[model samples]
Target: MRFLGFCLSMLPIPVIQQAGLALDRHLGDKAFEAQLEELWSAISTANDLVSKVSTLEEAIQEIAKTIEASPTLEAKTSEFIASLGSNQKEFSVLTENQSYQELRSSIVHADISNFVAIGGSTNVIQNSTVNSERTHLHATDNSKNFVDGTTFQGSGGAVSMRKITTQGQISVQGSGIGFGGEGGIGFGGGSSISFGGNSNEVSGNCPSCNELLRMDKRELHKYIHVQCHKCKSTFPFKLPNA
Candidate 1:
């Protein structure tokens, strides 16, 4: 019995199951039942270990895939950064080019032959010369007023100028109408009398009492003092060439 136990212990555990079954058939079931139960328990533990090892192998494969794609992701990131740097360098070169510098320093001359501006305010400041055939500005917006103050020493051609505001009074005061040329008339070519709207009539409200002051053709080119009838506050009203 001692020799049998020593020999069975020396054998592997898997073989021990078959050997114990054979011994049970030969000798009896009573002597080898505990050894068979222990062998079965060892087999269950080995099967569990095999299942855990299979799961561990799948996890290792996923980690290997991630590691293999890391270089591709890093390369794409580097390529994106390099593209931004290249675009910035190209933009810097374009801004520093000779043509770009010339465009920044060049003079812009716009030839507006026949121009008509309606419904807004326009300001023209000519230091040297302004040659125009006909220039007309009409302010149709009720919320704004048209105001023109031009001072020129010389002119080139005939200019028929007309400025009208829809809901505001027109104020024109300057030197001579035309400068340095014959028939260079200004502000309705000396035919217009009142200056407000297209109706050739000018009217305004008193600043003190809000009374309406209407201008007739007699009061067109005259420096007159108007008194508000409501509040009797007198104010000076002047016209061009008066």
Candidate 2:
């Protein structure tokens, strides 16, 4: 079922809607119809279209009703996309069953300016300057936050469970910044600076139990193995020179 959703999510919205409409017209089994509805809901949420469409099934119904009533569908879609850009941000309210894969892909492709995800697991932020105040303000996931020439700036901008992988440069500046979470990773190939008064930290999760392992930046040089108190398991870590 997950694989089906994965494949369908990659299809163009128009194609999916057409397939759904065809099924609606020809299919009759209630069980099969229910399954198709569930799949549509999952795909809609995954594609970050739930905000525009409460459910793909509903959207298809609306399309059926409007297909003959209008001829400017392309213009409407364009206007919708343009309006989203006006906010200069992408936001999602996710449940535990959801991941941020589709949304992350959008960020990477579109160079999205800001993002916010609430209550989702395995969230990722990459290849863009994410507003610290907006991204994952309240969520617990095995998050991997990357800074490829990106800055996680602002007061109260604390990234937990983060493995700062620098490709260009990363700066975790501001007071009251701390790191602690389940799992994290960021990719880059440049120098990183962690300063601005009490703001030098690193963290990652245990491979065995996914428990958070955190430490101050000063202790990174001597750091070799991180032990998870929850599972009594240890993992090796190689720190970049801070």
User: If scored against the real structure, what TM-score would every candidate get?
Assistant: 0.17, 0.24
**Model 2: ten consecutive residues of lowest lDDT:** 102-111
Candidate 2's residue-wise lDDT over 70-91, tens digit each? 4553244333222222323333
Model 2 score (lDDT): 0.36
Candidate 1 stretches with Cα past 4 Å from truth are: 1-115, 120-129, 143-149, 152-242
Q: In candidate 1, where is summed lDDT lowest over 10 consecutive residues?
A: 97-106
Top TM-score model: 2
lDDT of 1 by residue, 1-242 (tens): 32234234323222344445445464454434555344334333433432233454443333333323567533433332122212111111011111111011011111222111223322221111222322222222322222222222223432223332222222221223322223344433222222343232356889886867554323244446865533446787764342
What's model 2's lDDT at 45? 44
lDDT of each: 0.31, 0.36
Off by more than 4 A, model 2: 1-83, 88-90, 93-95, 98-120, 131-134, 137-150, 153-242
Question: Each candidate: RMSD to true structure?
Answer: 42.7, 17.7
